[model samples]
Target chain A: MVESLVKEYTGKLPVKLLGELKDKLTAQKINKTRAKKIFETTLQEYLDAQVAPGEAVGIIAAESIGEPGTQMTLNTFHFAGVSEMNVTTGLPRIIEVFDGRKNIATPMMDVYLKAPYNKGKDIRKLALLIKQSTLQDIIKEVNTDLMNGKIEVEILSAKLDDHGLAQAQLKKILEKGLKGVNVKIDGSLITLAPSSKESNLNDLYKLKEKLKKIHMSGLKGVTHVLPVKRDEEFVIMTAGSKLKEVLELEFVDETRTVSNDIYEIAENLGIEAARTAVMNEVFKVINAQGLTIDERHIVLVADMMCVTGGIKGITRYGIVSEKASVLARASFETPIKHLISAALTGEEDYLNSVVENVMINQPIPTGTGMPKLSTK
Target chain B: MPKVDPTKHILVPKHSKLSEAEQKKLFDKHNINFNDLPIILASDPAITHLKLVKGDVVKIDRDSPTAGKSEYFRGVQ
Candidate 1:
């Protein structure tokens, strides 16, 4: 929260910088006591709502406030202390805690739980259920988009159906679309562009064959592994991917696969991006009806994308340096917040600079004050 | 909420299968509503996630792993 940001600006400071800082601090509130309460209550309420028959809902470390300026210790609430509770995203869920006496606030990470079916559910289960339902809804939108677009040929369009026929449809569509137009399929001798000036269909057919082979081999799940070089060791990392492609695969059930265990990053990405088709033409629906999703959940989705695609750090590349991790954790909110703040004051470049710095771990201009302004 | 019917195949309350009518009479004498108590389904996660109505009685196959025996129980009506 911004309200906690305070700098002892001397009288000699420029009025412009001073005004900008004031406006920013005014916009962001220093959520001291409330942040902890919110974290505790949200986690607790999430667990409470999951009461099952003959199961007990236990509350441990439910109300805890981290020391000011200190990062919250990673505490996992588990099922009788067995399975390590993953933080949905690789990153922790954080909230700012203020030191009343020192007037300085710092962020802290929190954890939740998930037990067996007969046992009461925890925060993790609630979050997972929410995330799955949300993605399923998005998939519906994507499917709607795919349906609205006409393939220009009835034969190609006929390839698609209600469920479990994507590959069959795609193969049929490809065959129909490339018929006497440019290619010929005689038994196994596939003649691609025997008459046309191009033979791109040959390559497309080969690729499709490979994908079909992999699919038929029961390779239902594909994981893209990325090892991040941290210190001396490489850490296995996760990312998000588009949900549309996985859903369209017919073999892959979008609902069952949308679990914390899977490294699916986005509701739509890569070849699946076309799922937005016609239904998602209204951008407002993606933003408004797209569910008020938690930033961590989105990051988890992003992690899945990274894992499934074997790509590393799409968030880092697409988002600025200073704000990359935060944006990855919170996804849309952090970026939207900064963009809105910048837009309101015509300081878009300055905000961009801040984001870059944050991404790269550089000292922010607003926080901890300026190094040059020190009085000897 | 769907309408609650007494005729539907509801799970016999635990008290009803307690060996005799005297036990059920005693439980009722104590002013405890056994029918309103939560019941467990044999399904791993159970009826909570199924979006079942309030009065729906889920049939559960109760099993004892150690005893190697199982019996069907109609959860409370």
Candidate 2:
């Protein structure tokens, strides 16, 4: 009986809400006649809640979010408890997200692991494996011998062992990476000699600098890692984001691991992911500052920004300049430039949007003005 | 380059193409046409697996906090 009643309202009400309503009616053990009455009222209420046609939702959403935006703090640094990580928050983060800036101030990633990795078994080792380790980090001392035209270095085995890197692997990397230089390893001491006898000390000295920067192990761009305990699971919080490489790791939970860099997410995941990131990022900043704003407003902004299949900022060079009307684009910023370009192209302004109509001192085509009456 | 599995990503939702009958029904209900709706590029990574043409409409099943499960639509451009 409940199934038939829900089927009748299938197209009228949302499918999820209808299912919930059916479950609720079944749990209450309501009769057929009364259940029909309840369903009717709910359908009526939902229809009433929807926004009407010709409503100026854009302006309303702008005002709703903009009003609370003024109270946000300008501070960017937030000390993340015992982790000793500095995360960008508040107004600066909000700007970073909306600007669609390629390079963010503080790039970060929270890497969730799968199975045994999340269970805290060898989690620290996994963190070490993901962090970028350089030759400078494991070397005890580096010196140049001008007479021999070579560079000598003393390795710190303890530090090397902590990274779980083998001496043979280090030697192999040194031999492959350094050009025209032969690498020799004796106990804890290592030496790099120029392959050509005619080579001067200047060439050997430059090779010493290059040797310090050789990537030893771990993924590139992941500078620091800290395994943080949240509830019963351990998640690694990285200081820098290398989302594509990190997601490929066997231990990483690819579905849940996320990067704070919006551009990185778009480049790796998709625009929809970036859209959600923008909304979540903005809402997070707003919530942290103890400000209240409706989710609908943020959703509207995010949808508008991502509607064109790519992320565009709210700046003059972004969504605003792409408006259809020449007057609208000109009015936003750099008016003279837009006007001249439009004139050169013989552009026409339809005055369909709010800005152009208002510029012409006419009835703006929004709300009451959207619909026109024609006599028969 | 490694191919991304669009279906497995958590950020993306279930997207399906609307048939001609369903598309007409949606347009009639909203009192709008194809040009009136928002657009998504054919090259968008989110729908790379869908293999959509230029003017097709896609239906997105979004699990939202405010409205539970909500529906969003975009036209391919």
Q: Rate the local accuracy (lDDT) of all candidates.
A: 0.29, 0.86
lDDT of 1 by residue, A1-376 (tens): 3323223332323334345545654566536465435434544554566434332111111122112104333443332222432222101222101100111111111111112321332322222222212111112111111232211211222212222234444445445544443333343222333234443545444433332232211112322212233344322222223333333333222322221211122122211121111112112122333333222233233322222212222243332232423433334345677656556766534323243556668765442433346577
If you assessed candidate 1 against the hidden native complex, which CAPRI class would it receive?
Answer: incorrect
Which residues of candidate 2, in runs, are more than 4 Å off?
Answer: A1-4, A15-29, A79-85, A161-164, B1-4, B27-35
Model 1's DockQ score:
0.01
- Model 2, span A229-293: residue lDDT tens: 98899999888899988888888888889898887887777777888888888988998999999
TM-score of each: 0.20, 0.91
Name the runs in model 1 displaced over 4 angstroms: A1-61, A64-376, B1-77
Q: State the lDDT at A297 in candidate 1.
A: 31
Candidate 1 CA-lDDT value: 0.29
DockQ of 2: 0.50
Candidate 2 overall lDDT versus native: 0.86
Question: Which pairs of residues collide in candidate 2?
Answer: none
Q: Provide the RMSD of all predictions against the true structure, rounded to 1 decimal.
A: 26.4, 2.6
